[model samples]
Target: MKKIMIFGAASAIAQETAKLFARDGENLFLVDMNIGRLEAVRDDILSRFKTKIEIYEMNALDFDKHQELFDKAIQTLGGLDAVLIAHGTLPDQIKTQEAQEMIIREFNINCVSVISLASIAANYFEKKKEGCIAVISSVAGDRGRQSNYIYGAAKGGVTTFLQGLRNRMTHSGVSVVTIKPGMVDTPMTAHLPKSPLFAKPGVVGKGIYKAMLSGKAVAYLPGYWRLIMFIIKMIPEWIFKKMKL
Candidate 1:
């Protein structure tokens, strides 16, 4: 059984993905900000799958604590075969724009911390010469739209970082998968109206699981997001700017 560590294990998408891993008989080290929710997910998963699971409480913004958490996860899991970094925040564009601190806080949580954890994991995986590092980006990262440019920028940074990391890790046999999911229905988006474009967490979670296992460099969840983003990216800047996204 593979030992996998999932950051943000309490999230709907991460919980669903963890279940898939458990179903495959993989042991998991789950870390999240809320110990209660983490434990809930652990208990729920254990109720169905006979696999070992460990949980740790950590605020993703705790930059200095990142290495400590990774160390702990490695020790608890007995050696991690893979890691999934799924922690991120969906920020309010207008609020963030109005408050500089909010913008920085959101950016740090969504981009800086992710890169920090990924860097730590990359070092360990590079030495082992075999491991998978999968992170959840968003289709929003593909381009900047007025609707949510702040969130878009942060995810874009993550996507770009993964691209560079994947390039460097390829020689070391480390697999880096960037998951860009479209609108996923979760607590994070509860205030937003639902549409056909909105996908259930389970669907996105399964896509993440498959991408990690297959070591895909980049994956667009529900797959069609690829075409959707491609078409958006192709739009001419002047005309695109005229149309509100």
Candidate 2:
């Protein structure tokens, strides 16, 4: 059976993705900072599927803990076939402007932690010469809009970092996928204004599952956002600066 480790498994998208994988009878190692949320998901998965489900209470931002977490996962599951990076923090943009620490925290949670975790996964996969790493980035990374450019900037770093990792792993039998989800209706986006193109967590999870199976390099969740972001990315900088995105 394929064993998968999901970081930030308490997030809505992670929870939905866990359900999909559980239904397939895959062994899952669900990791999250909130023990309560992790236990709830563990119980839910146990109730629905007759498969192995391990829960890890972890803070993704702590790079020091990553090695220990990876060791424990490998010890419990034998080896990891795939890893899903879904943990992130969406800090208030206004607060970021006032506090450098807030901006740093956002970057650490959204970008640095991903890189740290990916490094561990890369080493593991490289040794085995086989594995998949799927990172959940955001459409916000495509361009820096006025409203949440700080968040967008961090996500942009993640997108670029994953792309580089993909390049590095191309010939090593390790597949790296970057998932750019646009307007996902999760707790993270609850306070944001509604969009016509908004997608549910389940929708994004299904897309990620398919992309992982297909070994897709990069995928935009909801699919249509691929074309939408393509057009947005094409807009000339002069016009882009004049209009609010």
Candidate 3:
């Protein structure tokens, strides 16, 4: 059984993934900004499985306090076998274009904070010389689009950062898994129209857990996003600029 730490425990995907771990008898250290919602998730998981559960209230953007949080979780769990960073904010591209402050705030939330948290996890895993650091990026990070370029740009930064970290930890026995998920039905994405392409949170979460176990460096879920983004990335810049995504 794994000793797992999830930074965004309250997120639908993270919650589902935690459940998967619980069912398998793994221990979990869950962190989220919403204490009430976090408590609900903790209770629900404990109700169904006989496993160790710990919850903490935290704002993901609070980078200054991240080291303390990671240390505490590691100490409580005895040792951590894996970590999942799932907290992120979707930025409005239109508002980002209208305000420089919006761009800064969005970047801070989606990129800066992620870098800070990943650093803490990476260093710990590197020293241990065995562990998995899985981060939930997005397929949008594969390329920029007219609609959500701001959010995509932030995710792109995370993808690139993971790439470099993966390179650095190549011989350290630590696996860095970058999970790029396509559209998923969640409260955060409630405004978007529903479709067959939009996957369920539980489905995506299970895919992520499986990818980590397989030690895959990069995974595109529900899988076909790989082909879709391949075509998008292959288009000529001139022709691409002329058409909408």
Candidate 4:
């Protein structure tokens, strides 16, 4: 059985991905800030899958403590075959603009914390010369839209960071996958109006699982988001800025 670690494991998307791994008989090391939700997810998985599962309570904002958590996960699993960083926050653009602290919080959670954990994992995986590293970025990173540029900027930084990581790991037998979902229907986006463009957590989770296993460099959930982002990225800035995103 494959040994895996999932950060932000209690999220709807993360839980769904965890289910697939559990069903496949893979051992999992899961963590989330919410202890109750983390335990609930662990219990639910135990109800169906006969696999080894471990849970830890942690807030990702504890950036300095990330290395400790990664080391602990490796110790718990004997060795980590793969790691998925799925934690991030969707910041309110208006609020962030009004409050400088909001922007800092957004970047800390979305970019800083994720990068910190990924850096630690990269070092470990580099030594082994074989492993998978995956992070959940977003299509928002593809372009800076007026609506959510702050959030987009953070994800964009993540995407760029992953690109460099992927490049460095190219010959090390490591796979760094960047997952950019369009509009995902998750608790993080509960206030947003849903439409056909929005994908369900389960759908995105399945895509993430498939991509991670395949070691694909980049994956867009529902697949179509790739084309959608392509067009958005291609538009001229002056012309694009005139239209509402």
Candidate 5:
């Protein structure tokens, strides 16, 4: 069985993805800020699949603890074949713009912490010479929109970092997959108005699972987001800037 570690195991999409791994009988090391939610997720997964699972409580912003957590996971799982970094926050755009503190904190949470963890994973996997590092970036990262540029910027940073990391690890037998999901229907987006563009967490979760296994350098969840983001990226700045996204 494949040994996997997920950093944001409590989130909806992460939970779904974890379940998929369990279905495959993979050993899992799940980490989240909330131990309660982590336990719930572990129990829920165990209800369906009998697989080895370990959960740890960790706030994504705890940069200093990242190495400790990773070491613990490695020790517990014996080894790791793949890792998924899924922890993030969808900060209120208006509120973030109003306060520099909010923007910095959110940015650190969404971007810096992810890069930190990925760096650790990259180093470990690079040494192993065979592993997968999959992260959940977003289609919002493709292009900045006035609606939520702060969050977009954070994810954008993640996407770019993954691109370079993927290149560096190409010959090392380490698969660095960047998963850019569109508007996913989770608690994160509950306050926003839903549209046909929105996708369910389970669908995105399944896509992430496949992407990691296939060693895709970049994957747009549900696939259509690829064309959609492509069209959006193709739009001229002059015309695009004048209209609402």
Candidate 6:
């Protein structure tokens, strides 16, 4: 059975992804800061799939804890075949503008923590010469709109960081995938306006699973968002800046 570790497993997308993998008999190592939610997900997975599911309370922002967490996961599962990075913080943009600390926290949660985890995973995969790292970035990264530019900036860093890691790991047989979801319906966006292209957590989760299996380097969840973003990206800056997206 393939061993998979999901960081930020308390997330809606992560929970759905866990269900998919559990049904396939994959051993899952679920990490999150919320112990209660983590246990709930663990129980749900075990009940539905009769598979091994371990939950670990983890704070991604605590860089020192990463090695310990990784060691515990490997010890429990034996080894890792794939890792999903799904944790992120989306602070209100208006609040971020008022507080410098909020911006820093957002960056630390969304970008710095990801890099820390990726570094740890890279070392493991490089030695094994086999592994997959799938990260959940955002379509907001494609273009920094005024609506959520800080969030977009953080995700953009994640996108670029994964690209760099992919470049370095190619020869080591380690694959890195970036999942850019446009507008996902989750607790994070519960209050956001409705959009025709918005995707459900399960939908995005399935897309990530398929991408991992297919060795896709980068993907847009729901697929159509890929074309939409492509066109948006192609528009000249002068015109793009003139109109609200």
Q: Residue 139: error of model 6 in Å?
A: 0.6
* Residue-wise C-alpha lDDT for candidate 4, range 144-181, written one tens digit per residue: 98899999999999999999999999789999999998
Which residue runs of candidate 3 sit more than 4 Å off their true CA positions?
none
Clashes of each: 0, 0, 0, 0, 0, 0
Better of 4 and 6 by lDDT: 4
* Residue range 50-94, candidate 5, lDDT tens digits: 999999999999999999999999999998999999999999898
Q: Which residue pairs come into collision in candidate 4?
A: none
Question: lDDT for every model?
Answer: 0.95, 0.91, 0.91, 0.93, 0.95, 0.91
TM-score of candidate 4 on Cα atoms, chains taken together: 0.98
Could you list the CA RMSD of all candidates, in the order they appear? 0.6, 1.0, 0.9, 0.8, 0.7, 1.0
TM-score attained by model 6: 0.97
**Tens-digit lDDT string for candidate 6 (120-223):** 99999999999999999999999988778899999999999999999999889999999999888899989888788778999999999999888799999989
Off by over 4 Å in 4: none
User: Candidate 3, which ten residues in sequence have the lowest lDDT sum?
Assistant: 88-97
* Candidate 6 or 5, higher lDDT: 5
> What TM-score, to 2 decimals, does candidate 2 have?
0.97
The RMSD (Cα, Å) of candidate 5 is 0.7
